[model samples]
Target: MRLLHLSDIHGRVDLERILRAFNELKADIIVISGDSESSSLLRDLAGRTRVFYVSGNMDSISVVETARELGMLLDGEVLDVEGILLAGIGRREEHDLNRIRKEVKGDWILVSHYPPLDTKADIASSGRHVGSRIIRNAINELKPKACLCGHIHESPAIFRLNDTVVVNPGPAFMGRAAIIDTENWEADFTRI
Candidate 1:
C-alpha cells in the first residue's frame, strides 16, 4: 500500500499542497502523526481519502474532537486497514502502550507525536534527544513495520530502527511531508 505521511501541520500547509501530493503520489492512505489543529483541512482531507490522526503537545482538545467527529482518530487504538494493522499512541501513557502490546497480534505501524528516544527522528534543534523512552522500548520489542512521527521540526529524514522503517516528515508548518510505498518500504521525503 502507498501511504502519505504528514505531521506538525500548524498552519503552514494549505489544502492545495496536500491534494496535489495525494493525487500525484496516488496515495492509498494518509497517516498524520500529530500537531494539526486545522479542522477544515482535516475535513477536506477526509473527503479525499482515508486519514488517521493523533494529537501532539501543541494541539488542542479540538483536534481530538474533530478527529472523533470525522471518525478518523488513531489515538490509543488499532485498526486493520486493508490487511495492515496500525496502532497509534497519541500520548506517552502506560495504558495505551500496554493495551497495544496486549492486543496487537501481528505486524503493525506505529503512529505517534514523539519519536523513539535518541533516534534520528527525535533530535531537537539543540542536539539533545527528546523522544519518548517508552516509544523506544516499544520499537525495540514490538518492532512495528514503520514508525511515523514528528515532534522535532528540524529532524525530517527516514531511518531504520532494527527491522522497522522510521519516517519523520518534519514540520508541515515548514512544507515537509513524505510518501511511503509500504510494498517496498521506500520513502520519498518532499516539501508541500
Candidate 2:
C-alpha cells in the first residue's frame, strides 16, 4: 500500500498542488500529522482520501469540530486500515504510554505531533536536538512498526529504533512530504 504522510501545514491551504500530486501518485492512504490551522483545508482533504489526523498545539477546538463534522477521526483514535492499525495521539505531554501499549497490535502505525526521544534531528530556534519524552516512552513500550510526526519544522529526520521507523516530515506547507510504501517498508522524502 502507498501512503502519503504530511504535516505542519500551518494554515496554508493550497490544495491544488497537493491534489495534483495525490492524483499523480495514486496513494491509498493519507496521514496528516498536525498543525493545520485551517478547518476548511481539513474538510477539503477529508473528502479526497482515507485521512487520519491529530490535533496539534496550534489547532483549535473548532478545527477538530469541523474534522468530526466531515467524518474524520480526531486525536486518540485507532483506525484499522487493511490489517494495519493506525493510531493517533494529540499534542499532550501527559501521554498515556500504558494505554498505547495495550491498544496497539500487529504492524501498527503511530502518529503524533512531536518526535520520539533521542532523535538526532536538529531543532529550529535553539539549534538543539530534542524529542518528546512521551513519544519516547511509547516507542520503548509499544514498539509500533512506524511513527510519523511533525512539530519541529527544522528537524526533519528519519530514525530507526529497534524495528520501528520514526519520521518527522517537516513542514508540509514548506513543500516537504514523505511517501511510504508499506509493501516494501520504505519511505522516501519528497520536496514539492
Candidate 3:
C-alpha cells in the first residue's frame, strides 16, 4: 500500500493544490496529524481519500465529532490496513502514551502530533534538542515499525530507534509531506 502523510495545516484552505499532487501520486491512505481549523476540510479530504486524523491542540470537539461521523478514526484507535496496523494517539503526549501502553498489540504504525524530545533527531531552532520523555519511553517499550508525527513546525527529522523509523512530516501548510510505500516499507518526503 502507498500512503501520504501530512500535518499542521492550521486552517489553510488552499489544500486543493496539495491534494492534487497527492492524488497524482496514487496513495492508498492519507494521514493528517493535526491543527486543522476547519472540519469541512476534513470532509473534503475524506471525499478524495481514506483519511486517518487526530485532534490537535487547536482542534475542537466538533471537529472530532465530524471526523467520527465521517467514519474517520480518532487518536488511540488502531486501523488494520492490508495487514499493517495503523494506530493513532491524538494530543497530550502523556495521556496518549498511557493509553497505547495498555491497548497496543503487535508491530504497528504509530501517529502523533508532537515529536518526542529525547531522540537524537529532535533538534530545536537554536540547535539544542528536546523531545517528549513519554514518547521516547513508549517507543522503547512498544517498538512499533514506524512512528509519524508533527507539532514542532521547524523540526522535521527521520530517526531510527532500534527497529522503528520515526518521522516528522513537519508543517503541511509549509509544504511538507511524505509518501510511504507499505509494500516495501519505504518513505520519501515531498515539498510542494
TM-score of each: 0.95, 0.92, 0.89
Q: What is the C-alpha lDDT profile of model 3 across 1-192, one tens digit per residue? A: 877888788877465866786778887888877777678888888887788887777888888788878877557677787788877778666666666676667758878776666664467777766666666777778887788877777787776788778888778888888887776566778774
Off by over 4 Å in 1: none
The TM-score of predicted model 2 comes to 0.92
The 10-residue segment of model 3 with minimum total lDDT is: 113-122
Better of 1 and 3 by lDDT: 1
Strongest candidate by TM-score:
1
Put down candidate 2 lDDT per residue, 38-87, tens digits, no spaces: 89888777777777787787989898778767766546667788888888
Candidate 3 backbone collisions, by pair: 76-88, 116-131, 116-132, 117-130, 117-131, 117-132
Candidate 2: residue 71 Cα off by (Å): 3.4
Model 3 lDDT at residue 158:
73
**Alpha-carbon lDDT, every model:** 0.85, 0.78, 0.76
All predictions: root-mean-square deviation over Cα?
Answer: 1.2, 1.8, 2.0
CA lDDT of 41 in candidate 1?
Answer: 87
After best superposition, candidate 1 residue 55: deviation in angstroms? Answer: 1.0
Error of 1 at 169 (Å): 1.1
